[model samples]
Target: MTKCLGLVAVLAALGFATQASANQDVQTLASDPANWAIQSGDYSGHRYSKLDQINASNVGDLRVAWTFSTGVLRGHEGGPLVIGDVMYLVTPFPNVVMALDLAHEQKILWKYQPKQDPFAAAVMCCDTVDRGVQYAEGKILVHTADTSLIALDAKTGMEIWKVKEDDPKNGASGTGAPLVVKDKVIVGVSGGEFGVRCYITAYDLNSGHRVWRAYSMGPDADMLIDPDKTTSLGKPVGKDSSLKTWNGDQWKIGGGPVWGYMAFDPALNLVYYGSGNPSTWNPVQRAGPGGKRIDQKWSQTIFARDADTGIAKWVYQMTPFDEWDYDGVNEPILTDLDIDGVKRKALTHFDRNGFGYTLDRVTGELLVAEKFEPDVNWATKVVTDKSDPQYGRPLINKKFSPFETGTDDVTKGICPSSMGAKNQQPAAYSPLTSLFYVPVTRLCMDMEAFKVSYQVGQPYVGATLTMFPAPGENGNTGAFIAWDGAKGKTVWSKPERFAVWSGALTTAGGIVFYGTLEGYLKAVDQKTGKELFKFKTPSGIVGNPMTYMHDGKQYVAVLSGVGGWAGIGLAAGLTDPEDGSGAVGGFASLSSYTGLGGTLTVFALP
Candidate 1:
């Protein structure tokens, strides 16, 4: 099971590596607003659309325009890829890719399913999930559950070229979507819970050639970091940047499975992504001599790298010596914000650590970091201004620090839980409203960490915990809120009885749409958190909402199937409410609300 293929894709750090030569066709298609040409819809990672035919004023009149079933009953995360008259969709394990003829009443034009090892699904930390696909250079890029990155002809669904990015034997899997940076397809894997060293690799988009691969933690050459030129918080990080902080070779199995969404800046020639958490959730096991915190270098960090060379420009580590398994791998929404009368290129992120951070994307300067959830108690506040010596660090509350309490000390009343304030359910940024619509979990946990050894292809997690709704907000488990990243403040909040595990989508129509675990797709006013429309889908939803223009009409689409970490109990047919560690124990009520289902429900005005 210990397949040493060499990688270090640790969790959510928002590293930067974007379009090198600029795929002109994808650039034009994404710019036209007629097609969702990329996995994140655009490089900005806004998850927002310009189509407004179905505005808030008439969204109530919207009806089901079309629907298609993937025939796979598992969690559906990302939305479909609608490029012109063709639409592309992917499913959970044994990854299946289907090209649908949008003009021909949603006819199945072609389908390609990979024959994968069943063991891949068996070893996943949570449940099997593939975040759809990405499109570039007339090819559909697929990151399969078995760690295979393949390219299929967009029109025929025929295999163009394929590469084994990582071996499943080592517990490596690719759940997040691959990103196309010009001619290079950048990919990251998820297996942090399996205790595998992780990294991001860039392959040529057309030829499937390995361009450059960078590890999350290790030697400077291995990470492609320039000791003198590469920086941390605007200062150069000298040689042995990663090795110095780690205790011996512990960084080798230190999980860096960065399986989250990525963003790019064409002008900066940078690719952005977040790395995963360190391995062995028990901080006591990862401690240095004399019980000092092991600052596992590069894990739980955000990075900006030169797209072509894959060298780090700058990096900022959040949740250093992480004790709560807070991965830095959230979606980094890039936008230009005028802060203090100065227009700055900004990247805003809603972290699993329960903080909304906005940083200067160009220089990696810390701009704003504030708790989106008021009840978040792990940290008091982040020092935002560079003037302070403690800038960019969260002031930890020792009362909730698992590492502080040591091994076997059951830490109670930790807000946000290890599920974080949010999961992969991405938020949306609307320029019109200048706000971020976030769909998030509102649960607290009681956790106990024990020493655990790293075993490849097996869960290396050392924490066992149970979850319940957080205190305040009437004991609700989820909420949809509007946030102003520029000011690091919440604009409004709307509570949900269950977790809002679905992604949010905002449109020029002035509405933000998100789905609830109860199967209700709710469209609300963008400015205010007022509900505008709600429709029940066939099952609970964990998919992101997307919009596209077809035949001069605007349409919105989302996939409904409940089987992510939050719905693993029903999807995996597990009777134990405590299965998946505590996932079932936390979200066991979801089984009573909806059963397993897999269907794409598209909405449009009649």
Candidate 2:
């Protein structure tokens, strides 16, 4: 007994349980494709694995290896994490964390499920989705729907440290996964519709001490922005940047919720993320200059900030004076590309505003900006000329603009519903194919703008919308497309009956995998976008698909649960055809196909 005790103590002293030695372990594991270490797979947010054991030719032979039930309802947005011989899974609300031993007959090694107030679900905007979990060193990180971030022992499932990040009762909750960057874990808050000010906070990984908190929109100090240092369009953003954009203390509730995938660049020591839509979705209520560009400074913008100090490096506003509720909370994929005979570092982003943008991740230079959806008509194009005073702003078509049409008027046939061309479903970039596999929502809407007064922690949205499939596209509502980010072109597209809500996975096998709202896990040719193999899941899949290798066999896994905006119309019995408050009545057709469920399916070549 004395000898065993000393051995355990020696192991702990040798980079076993301490947080200071955690970064190197995570970095090494993340560098490996055999283990899906982080939420984005790697810091680049590529979601592409380098394992080629299950190639495109053999992917069609994939059979069910095993399955597990999360036993929770609502949407599951993120995927699972696999490290060594264990698989970690997290649920939606009560946020149950399960560590399953893969070596054995998939035994439950340990489970960590929290008990909390059921009323915490009220603060959630949509389907009460938890993006998933993160693992680093020997700890599993979880962000709960009730505004809590927890770290647990990877081996024993014991609580290492837990912190209350926000007040769910006060209308601020975090649904996305927390990202671990070196010695810190970063989290972004969500409350755009609740009129609550949002920010991204980073904490010390070891002691759970708050390191920095940067607001989405506020004064320079609160935002942690350097007046003459942080820049846009290659020029300094002067003082009062966010303050001058709003009227009076409106910036207090300025809704720039950074509640989505954030990618980091270790070489540059910068982290990149986008903010959500501004408060009071009604354009008329958020007053601005009529003919000029309303610089809602950081909302609907991409921000590159110093990971350690939380100082803004640069920013690019995707939508200036956004009249539509296009939250710019999608992932920014980092990679190097040769653009127009010049080899440059590129950061590609698919915005909720129906445009795919590629910029220099290092310098924040706009290299390519084009409409991934051919029918997108919100704005003709993004102005990319740096010299133009109108640079980085969209050339709006006033006919579809709610702001231009004035209050109480309904704007008709605005392509790309407030959901944008896509929501938080992440796109996968294959460095092998030089193409991005994107899951698209071909949705459009008719929005009516009105007046609304903001009250503390209350819903401040002032718009009513009715959604439908984009016109002239048969009756299909979604598609899987292969895009060339350097050229801003779609190489191939395959239409889907419903929105392709799952996150995409592209492996060295040359196959792109994603799930459909009809409960099918599909594999398509990475080169041609041809459906090669597909299997019906237990329910509609809104979660991301992930790939990992254990015991020399490649395994692909995905979570299936139908409760996002597209399926919530059925899950919650919402009957209004024009309902657009998170539950889209346009997707009522899903009632005939799927219902509420939560299951994880794994596949491997037989």
Candidate 3:
């Protein structure tokens, strides 16, 4: 009897040890400081982590623990969200929602698939993929490809409610990530190429009810006569308003799609977003009736609108009557910069026009506008007060022809291609290093503009753009630039053969995480741009990197699949048609890896 009692006591002690270990795993995920709210670390849009367990010194020792492939194919740009011990991610095409249980060895808890329309593929100008989903109010909000917004229960992945935000007949969809502020889910409509007028809408989190809507172009009342009267914001002054800049109802069909990332400041109660370029490749098609020439306002502008009311607080137009396809749809990063001796809350954006701009978030004042590239000929310098550059204006010479706009010429190479310095990829702002890490494509384009007219359902304009090596540069690839926002200078840079399609993420450990078009996930020093670590995934990594703590370990996660615009172009050139029969030249390669599908891989320290 004594021996039996002693054995029972030993078994009880072992049971207590197992329970303690289980509790420790939960604590690691719950108390992790690196995983926080929103994109980056907070509302500031700084994608910097405060955890040092995976610092630059120890990053070299990192290894992959697991990978989750959705097999959805197409482009994989969705960045995953880590909350508690669960991981949430979005897939391409139909924009499926997935939840994974981290404590149970990264097992998928549930998957929510949205009903997508097959005809929607024909309207998508680029690839059919979403950047990511937003987590707010105990629910995961995902914008579907069918123009519907669905809310999922965070724990069960069950549909809480689904709301259709746009008319399917108008060719409107949601490809960009949804931004959640308090109870409002702010989202924008995409499908500019299909002649759809764009708009931004906000919805309630609890009820999935729309709060307010703001159109990119003014209504018929404002476009024809008084511009201010058409919009929610009152009229503009004299000739400065966008209405006076245009001629006779041309503003009615002007395109300014808000198909990019948005940032918000709770302190100021402002949600800022950048607008896309005008419709059609040709300005002649959008020019005023009878021969009147007018400059369209707000097409390529950064607007700061009230979060709750959808009222325009201030707008800084980057390119006023933009003849080039220079869409200002890049991510707008919010930060506080020390300009001269004054500390100002500034908004930083690396525009597609090859210029990096710093503006006062509160007043929309241009703080610093400088060219980050060497061969930016379109603009000599950005005006401090106004957003216009010093160079690149259209000249109306009859010799140019009715078919050709004077600005479009193959010989007169554009400084930055339509891809610009940075495209849709998100940049990282590290508060620890006081720097912004940007992945820039160092390439130029030979552009010949053509006269374009807006018709109901046909191609409106024509321009030929051929990618070339940067001026005095030999390669046609990309570079990782460490920009010091405080000093407005390039601290360090690393070049590559292919553009860095993936966005960047910085950690408190002084390491920056990003992926390359060549299928390598890399970790670099935030200050020196030194390559500390790298891991090759299934395919090229185009998505952003995110970090989360699970089971007492820090895990790094990213998606790997090749199907975006750049990926399709590169694959067409690299893969021979003979090698793969029945493959179309340009975007045909996008379907090659379509079967390989999309994947979300996670890594942890062993």
Candidate 4:
């Protein structure tokens, strides 16, 4: 008995030692910028992977390692979180969380499905898929479909706690991925299209306690005040001046949903998020009487807020009084670049308004603003001096204008469809190659406006956007372009049959990875944009691709299934469906592929 007791203690001690060593290794990997520690890969939000095990030279030998289907049929846009040998993913609708053992033939260690309210689906502007999950402080945090944030034991998939972000009766939900920095879990609210006041909030990871809340539209006095008591962006206005830009206190309920993934610079301590358009598709409703103040304070703007205090550092409004539903809620990628002659840290965005912008990360100054889209009639040019558009504002009563015409039809032929050339799907930058790889569409939209009315829960504004082929462009196809970030010039371009809906992933091996809407996952030459390798999946692929090494073997993974704005539009014939929509086609086809289902496909060297 004594011998047995001693042996048991020895085994226990060995287990402890192994756990400690494993934890230390994880800490080392997590802290390294080369391992993609943040959402966009090391706070720069570049979405570029540094490891280069699978280079363009050897990409042809890449084969599927394994595939895990979530069995949930909605749109799958969530990117996978690869930490060590375990990969974490979030699914749509029920918002189930799954942890897979990548080293063990993609074995599912555990799956977590948080209880969600069914009615929440009604408020989602897009599909119900959660963008991704955050890993911090030994916990995995995810936002559910019903506006609830749940923290789970990363290894066990057990729920630690849950926090509700909205009152179900008021109609608000969350679909974007939460950003975890230090001990705070930062998340933005969705449901702005449904007329809810949108805001971003931070919660304590340890206790699930609310730290601070910053509303997208609110009284100046109520905006997030710097707890440090610093006079940052000046004092908040009391009454009339605060509401001057907006008519009739509409600012109180104006919609500016921060629904897309946001990036952060820990060094600068600034959190950057692009705000959506104001409530009511009609600008006439929000902008009453006179134009008053030209640019709305923060709506449709790229906001730089103090990461710790939630105070506005600086804001650059992308569009003034956005009426075309071209919300600026795209990925704000952070990266360091050499602009012209000087080296500077920058935040770049491929805005939905048909322009790409590079701004000084610290001060929010526009450095370069150029049009990347083929056809953009709404805006003649983006004024870099003022960080505003020179010719995009719609006049209230002008003839032939989108607003006064009240023609909500596609034949009118507007350039750069609402989806923009690039949408929420993030692009990736390869420091090794010094080029930015993005999936761009060459489609146009004909938009007609409608008069809007302010209502609590109803869609006030109306706009019908019809997708058309670009002028002189062939089909509604997409192209993968490698852009010189510093020079703002196209390095290379490759035409694709369908839009590249997923985000790009560039590795150290000079390879750029992306998935197409038609379910083909391919690797392209990072420098030349040459298609080096390709593989087909069951359904269309829209989720971002992630690369990680497991058990000394590097693997690339992406979620497959189609159902976002672009996916829905293509499926429903809103745009020209590359798959040739069945004879009687319309928007009804948007929900047609629900049976297509969601899947997680992983690849590795044969």
Looking at model 3, which ten-residue stretch has the lowest summed lDDT? 578-587
| Top candidate when judged by lDDT against the true structure | 1
lDDT of each: 0.87, 0.87, 0.70, 0.70
TM-score of each: 0.96, 0.95, 0.85, 0.86
Residue 586 displacement in candidate 4 (angstroms): 9.1
Q: Residue 485's C-alpha lDDT in candidate 4?
A: 63
lDDT, model 3, position 386: 36
Candidate 3 runs further than 4 Å off: 1-37, 219-240, 288-293, 385-411, 451-461, 570-597
Task: Estimate the overall C-alpha local distance difference test score of candidate 4.
Answer: 0.70
Range of the 10 consecutive residues with the lowest summed lDDT in candidate 2: 13-22
| Model 3 RMSD, rounded to 1 decimal | 11.0
Per-residue lDDT of 392 in model 2: 76
Instruction: Tell me the tens digit of each residue's lDDT in model 1 across 1-606.
Output: 223322212211233323334666677788878788876778889988888898989999889998999999988888799988999999988779999999988999999999788888877777788887998878999999888999999989899999998888998988989988878999988889988899999999889999999999999999999999998888888898988888888888989778889998887878899998998888889888788976788998898989899999999888888889889998899999988789999999999999998889988898889999887999999988688898888899999989888788899999888888988889999999889999989888888999888777788999888888888768679999999998889999999988899999888899999998878888999998889999999999999888899989999899999888888887898867557767787887787789889999999999
Poorest stretch of ten by lDDT in candidate 4: 578-587
What is the descending TM-score order?
A: 1, 2, 4, 3
* Residue 8 error, candidate 3, Å: 59
Please provide, for model 3 over 265-375, each residue's C-alpha lDDT reduced to its tens digit, 9 standing for 90 to 100: 766778889888777656666666664455577678788877777877777767656656778788889987889899998999888877788888877767777777767
